[model samples]
Target: MRIFRFSLLTLCLLLSSIISFTLYAANDWYRPPVAVSWYWQLNGTVNENHDVDLYNIDLFDSSAELIQRLQASDKKVICYFSAGSYEDWRPDADQFAEKDMGKTLSGWDNERWLDIRSTMVHQVLLRRLDLAVEKGCSGVALGEVDSYRTNTGFYFRQDDQLRFNHIMAEEAHQRGLAIGLVINADQVRELVDYFDFALNEQCFEYSQCSSYGAFIKNEKPVLNAEYRRIYVDDKEERNSMCQNALTLQFSSILLSKKLDGSLYKPCR
Candidate 1:
């Protein structure tokens, strides 16, 4: 009885330590709210005039001073990068091995799908995350994260994608950086607990906005961008879209497909 009691006590202490560490890890990083007003611009000069809570800009294009300027203005900046695909224009594009490169993404030239299971790929992305840390980004917006749902000329099981995403999230947290799942709505329920937030593109147009209810219910932010012309050209479409977004508690905005600063209509 004495031995059993000591073992039980040991187990209890171990469990307590684990729970404490998990909570610490979760709270140690940044957590954006469900109602956060954010902007996503990948091209041209980043417009800083919007009364938004966060700015999502290209990771490489943004200067450290720009990140500092945004943070100084009391806005959180989420550095953007393509984690699941290889973009040839990046400075570190050559770091990806030929074997890891797959078919080109539709309508996106010079960008090819990457093998999600590559250790080398993970290392390269680790450096990208490090860059985010070095540049003082509050969080990272990982694009093309739903490679499993695309025709990437690679055989990626759902488990493979999940493992890869988990690695990215774990590594991001290890560096005290928050990360969001960009447009990977299919895995929203499974990954909501792991990611800090969700960024969906055209979910309203495609009738996929409901998938992100999981994020809102969990009190995590769902930042959606609609590029459809109807939302921009018609007042009725804009109102309906904004209504759904408001009902869903999403930080929705109408943006250009180019993602330039020329377009900005946010529905808070």
Candidate 2:
């Protein structure tokens, strides 16, 4: 009887230790800093020798095999998905409820804003995160999360946006993946704290790049994309952008409007 009691206690202690260690290890897995080179176009193959730490690619456009290939080359992959908007062209577009969708995204015809407050939208996003994990993605870039600030037709307030963004971050973290926030320049101050990193579009073009310095200050990288044609045609503009990016320590890339795999240049 004494021996059996001792054995049971030992088994319980071992199980507890294993559980604690697993939890710690899981927390450490998703906390690594991200340094990504983005390729949205489908034409040219990814240049694996750019000294970049990560590659952000379209979740649907690039297959799991391609992501595995990049990882085999010792690069982390961040899968890009539109979490807060309903894109009509996506394969999973039919899954979104019509009532959960709001106004069409300004300047974007094929996409519409999603009601962040809707439980249905949350369920869809959770499935998307699950898809990311299943596809072997190291992290996720949740695009267009600032719908509340726009004319989303949902009558969303700032507090609602904050709640939704925080929930998104928490859900990503829970899945052992880092989440990046792609927000307009105006909401950076409010949403920066909830995101692991940031993906900003045309901040340099608008002279709002300085507003995102907080992320760099916190040792988090800010990946900026510029879509201006001059950056590609004019050597002078490219030089200036490169110099500015180098000084700011921000990873900047000039991409075409199509987001097809054509990368003009990278500002290191």
Candidate 3:
């Protein structure tokens, strides 16, 4: 029998290369470590020079070429879409029956909560996933996923929400895409296992930062957005918030509530 051998240094280098290659191959999905900076812009022309690791952009608005550009620069892209809401402005809006829509989202005129359990809604969302695939999105950030927590004019048991969320995760994974839950802190524990990341809004301001502790503990990135006017101008307040976020190991930013690319502040 022939024996094959490698020196200690050669073996270490080989193992390091294997680990790097595994991570490189898994670029189809995002699994960010603690404190990864990311950018979220749902409106206006995407400002692609943020020096961030990830870009969450509107799935319908971002062109495939833009996504390819970001990936070419070694950045991951997470396509944004309402998984549990109906947006009348979307290209596929006409596909949703009026029955599938619930009350208008309080602040947004064009958005309405969706009947998450409806079969038609599922089909529409499946098509959205297909769009994400065609755009070469590394993953997706599913908005309004915790619809059961709101008065959406549709009855939803907690288990119904869980089932819906699980299916979203399963489907995205099956398509080789990672999935994130947005502002759905209530089910962090329940979904931490299924979701690749969590996108939170004002969790620190609401004293809800601790809700995503499980995500940090799991080594999954928690992208928190703080819209406080203070964060945009007051250095002391902004520093304090950043300190708290850093302590929590969260990747946080201060932005306009519009998410219109009007403001951008990342907690280092």
Candidate 4:
């Protein structure tokens, strides 16, 4: 009888462990819902007055107090930072090595493609993620994860980008913060499960919005922005786009190409 009781107790403990692990695996991150309203302003002082479900703002430029204030207003904050590129104007710009720098981005002359495989670059990104945690951000928006598809000067293939992106996602999750994929639609299939949500630009304008449908299928949010002038200036065109965006189940917004806090037109 003693041996039988001991075995039963051990089985009960094992079952409890399994249940705990499953719960952790299932909800280890904050997954944004489809069609959730969000304000995207990464270029200037964030206007926290927008009544939305989420706010994607600059990680470095925005202060810890601002994040707390947004949280106080019942908003989830997604801190934005360029994880896959090296910006010359950032406060930690001097920490990057010359060898780690690559070709300039097509339109943004001040920003350059980063060697994502570099340990030095990874260290810098880790520090940035730590900063997001320190500031009490709910999630992080990692920009430029698709530099492999650009003229980045580095010969980064799909695997390289995937490994680097996984590292970023893992680091964010480790700190109990969610992470979003930014405009890397090509790798959506491989990365959908890794990232909590997506931050896309011009997917509709480029006819690539369908590529992000996988997120909707999996019950994840695809926060999108269309910078086309017609969508911003013409009410008819904007309504038409919003109609399609609703059908696609995307959280769409209209903004200027500059991404300043000035222009904001939600599709809902």
Q: In TM-score terms, which candidate is top?
A: 1
Off by over 4 Å in 1: 1-26
Query: Where is the poorest 10-residue window by lDDT in model 3?
Result: 21-30
lDDT of 4 at 6: 55
How do the residues 90-185 of candidate 3 rate in per-residue lDDT, one tens digit apiece? 999999999989999998889999999999999999999989999999999998898898999999999999999999997887777888889888
Writing each residue's lDDT as its tens digit, candidate 4 over 71-108 gives: 99999999999988888889999999999999998888
Q: Of the pair 1 and 3, which is ahead by TM-score?
A: 1
Q: Residue 4, candidate 1: how far off, in angstroms?
A: 38
Please list all clashing residue pairs in model 1, or write none if there are none. Answer: none
TM-score of each: 0.90, 0.85, 0.88, 0.89
Off by over 4 Å in 4: 1-28
lDDT of 1 by residue, 1-268 (tens): 4554458889999999888878766678889998898988899988887889999999999999999999999999999999999999999999999999999999989999999999999999999999999999998989888899889999999999899999999989977799999988788888988899999889988999999899988999999999999888999989999998998899999999899988899985
Maximum-lDDT candidate = 1
Question: Lowest summed lDDT over 10 consecutive residues: which window, candidate 2?
Answer: 34-43
Sort the candidates on lDDT, descending order: 1, 3, 4, 2
The local lDDT score (0 to 100) that residue 203 gets in candidate 1 is 90
User: Which pairs of residues have clashing backbones in candidate 2?
Assistant: 40-259, 41-259, 41-260, 41-261, 42-260, 42-261
